[model samples]
Target: MSLVAEHVSVSIDRADLLADVSFTAAPGRVHSLIGPNGAGKSTLLGVLAGDRAPDAGRVLLRGRRLDEWPLRELARERAVLTQEHGVTFAFRSREIVEMGRHPWARTPAEDDDEREIARAMAVTDVAHLADRPVAHLSGGEKARVALARVLAQRAPVLLLDEPTAALDLRHQEDVLRLARAQAADGDAVVVVLHDLNLAAAYSDEITLLQRGRVAAHGSPAEVLTAERIEDVYGQAVEVIEHPRSGVPLVLPVR
Candidate 1:
């Protein structure tokens, strides 16, 4: 099973934002989308999550087109975490996560909703904040709480946009590690990341986009190179092998 982006394109008014872009986020792995600002990472993610309709091509989940999937079935199949997590209420953190169970409401799955919620919170290291008001939390804390909600969703596919943008170093690693663990469990995890090091460390495959088009798509070793980094990011960077892990490590050139 895979979340496929088949020759997707997008245009606003008369300008193109994406053109003939294609991607495949396969099950049982973590795929990362990386690019400079305005590279259409979030736009592509929105299409994959079925929130935006492309002007050309389509997004498919498993083998079914995204537009054709019933809303409830799509919710059950995948969970989307956008850049913004809006909470209008002063609801407790637990309440926010419990909302993830909405798809299972009135169904047999409802019986274990609380258990699922608890497990999700625990995994995201937010269980202790379950009783706290979501609005009172710090940005990092809120990000983790938001992530707990998605974990509670128990969807087979995860599409996250900059999931670690507001986190501390430790928590940043925490989130990526959890993403890896989710992929290890056979879930398809697709994340948009700005930090190339983190993506190199955790992603099984990386898709590099430039000007709304794919520049490279391959294993980290194949896509992330000193030359490619300089060409796409327009900054001098040195790509080196990790001392032990051998994954690519990107460092700014002096």
Candidate 2:
């Protein structure tokens, strides 16, 4: 599935949160949104997920307007992982994961519920924590559990908002690698990332936003240049090539 945002704009209290932003997340590609804080990365992601209505412009999923899709249909088409992973009640980890299969209830797909839930938990390395109360888990554990729920949904378009924020270095790599694997399996993955290096390493295309507008949009090499990073992030940085992958390595100059 292809998720597209065209001329999308959002405003809050007379302030523009996003202005004329256009983006595309195509199958078999990992497209990343990267920018400084308050650059509207989360806001734009919310719009793309159909959680917030844009003040202007439109969002499309597979050539159809987002609003045109029914809520259940939309849920089956896209899975969103927001920054907040808090659960009000003490739901078990496995139970939380099972929620992702709710959309397929009563349908033939529901027969795979058990298998999919277990697969998602195992893939996220949270299978051992299945029966544990999510409220008792650490922040990183909760994040992984939340991700397991999203993965269990089996949605084609993934809208992840800083999915690795609470994870350690190794788990961060694990999450991004899973994202890449999903894209390789022909899912359209759109991730909001703060780590420019990870974005450069995993993203097939990058959109750099500043003050609600697009600063650059292209491959990592084209959009993540030292000059562009410094201009948008207001920090001096040096770009080097990774010895193994040859992707751009961003190091802040101190």
| Cα lDDT of model 2 by residue, 191-226, tens digit | 999999999999999999999999999999999999
What is the lDDT for 74 in model 2?
A: 94
Clashing pairs in 2: none
Which pairs clash (backbone N, Cα, C closer than 3 Å) in model 1? none
Off by over 4 Å in 1: none
Provide C-alpha RMSD values for all models, in order. Answer: 0.8, 0.6
TM-score of 1: 0.98
Model 1 Cα shift for residue 232 (angstroms): 0.7
lDDT of 1 by residue, 1-254 (tens): 69999999998997778889999998899999999999999999999999999999989888899999999989999998889876888999999999888988888988989899999999889999999999999998899999999999899999999999999999999999999999999999999999999999999999999988999999999999999999999999999999999999999998
Ten-residue region with minimum lDDT total, candidate 2: 8-17
